[model samples]
Target: MSAQLTAPQTPAAAPAAEPAGRRPRRGTFGLASKALVNGLLAISAVYTLAPLAWLLIASSKNRKDLFSTSPYSVGEFHLLRNLSDLFGYDDGIYLRWLGNTVLYTVGGAFLTTVISVACGYAFDKYVFKGKEKLFGLVLVGILVPSTVLSLPLYLLASRTGLVNTYWAVLIPSLVNPFGVYLARVFSAGYVPGEVLEAARMDGCGEVRTFARVSLPMLAPGFVTIFLFSFTAAWNNFYSSLMMLNDQNLYPVNLGLYAWSQNTHQQPELYSLVIVGSLVAVVPLIVAFLCLQRFWRSGLTSGAVK
Candidate 1:
């Protein structure tokens, strides 16, 4: 009788131990799923980074090594030599082009952001006659391609004796309809009515309230608009090409295009052009990396509601 009771208790204990063993299998399956997801992300990251890595490596090599050496391997590192040769190749024209790009980007971006923000804020806060009609017009403007308008704009600039000048490029770039639309969206989300009401009740003037209260709230939107305008101006090729006849006024994009055209005739310039392209991309990367935190926060703040 004692042996029978002991045997029954052992069978019950075995069933309990079996569940404990099965728990590890379930944990392992979960870990495997996580591992698979992580691996895929790693692969995607590598694919995205590969081109940038190649650009860096290629830029380090000179003309001879660039063509002959392995694309992945670092060949006799001559980045400084390449940069010096790049700057001195044509009476330091590259430096001038860089300066022109900076000026265009900074000037165009500043004016565009200010104008867009003002337009957007007014559209959001003010209730005036023809508001919807005007906004509809703005939407139509957004749909109109910049390329199509380029010819008309060029003609107008020529008539005004502004063609081939910086103003011609700067003025058109400042009137970005898309930027205005983005600004309106950002203003609607960021600038709360309560805050504006509070400011007004405190005896603040409209302009004063906007500068102190609204502008601070719209900083992230301003940064976003600035970056968009800056990138567009920096990369603008057709407008710059059409507007300017002088080499001194050329931005880096047009300058690079000129070099690329000559590459077929003077193949040595091929390496220089490649190297220059690699160098040209660095500022954009740096700007994005620096401003990404603010951008992320701003986007998320608007999205959370």
Candidate 2:
């Protein structure tokens, strides 16, 4: 009678499974690791910014205040006066040096970008004689630092009587092997072979296909190469110094170096040099700010293909 009256017991419910792709809740260890990473990142940011901060402060101060004051502290803001001296000194020759730098950087960067895009596209799309070998040579060039080539470049420039001329700096910069490599990587990712085939089927010339179809796709590559060449040409002190002796043809980097060298005899030039250095940084800052979108977008350009 007792057994017959007994009822069946129910089973306990199972725990629910987490949804697919959802990350598990971070534990204390995970949180600690995240905090550690963030702290490191903050330290890096401060490390990178310290020089620029010093530059700003140094630029604002007179020479008397620069050495005596704390690096982060503000001083006698002779910024306006320093700028006037910077521009007005030596019949405004600093402006000429600035112009020289702009010309070299812009002209060289543009040419380098175009040539790099062309070469990279060729390496990626067209199968030809010694293609891989040629590309390998380019990779080799990347491994070889620019300083290694500076002497050879100077010798070649001398042979052609291009020394002390704008062409000396501009020519070598235009042949950026790194740019070519980047272009190839970009072409592989950005410019689809199908698009090129379609363009060809529609009777588009190779040059036309590249110009109308591939060039637009390679926008990120172009900006990256342009910035590289610009920086190379702008800070090209050793090559410029090796090739150029005439002050008239000197880039701002060399010009500033010359001023810095003379500072022992002329202590007042320190303010001018500091001000010039600050001003020199502005164009690069502006360029990066303007093209930063392209640079960021290009990061994923070669990531896929």
Best by TM-score: 2
lDDT of 1 by residue, 59-141 (tens): 88988888898889998988888888888988999889889888899878899999999999999999999999999999999
Quote each prediction's TM-score: 0.84, 0.88
Give the runs in model 2 whose Cα sits over 4 Å from its true position: 1-26, 296-305
**What shift in Å separates residue 103 of candidate 1 from its native position after superposition?**
0.9
Query: Across residues 222-248, which tens digit of lDDT does each residue of candidate 2 receive?
Result: 898899888888888888888899999
Among all windows of ten consecutive residues in candidate 2, which has the lowest summed lDDT?
Answer: 296-305
Each prediction's RMSD to truth: 7.3, 6.6
In candidate 2 the C-alpha lDDT for residue 72 amounts to 86
- Report residue 54 deviation for candidate 2 (angstroms): 0.9
The total number of steric clashes, by the backbone 3 Å criterion, in model 1 comes to 0
lDDT for 103 (candidate 1): 84
Candidate 1: segments with Cα more than 4 A from true spot: 1-40, 296-305
**What value does the lDDT take at residue 115 in candidate 1?**
95
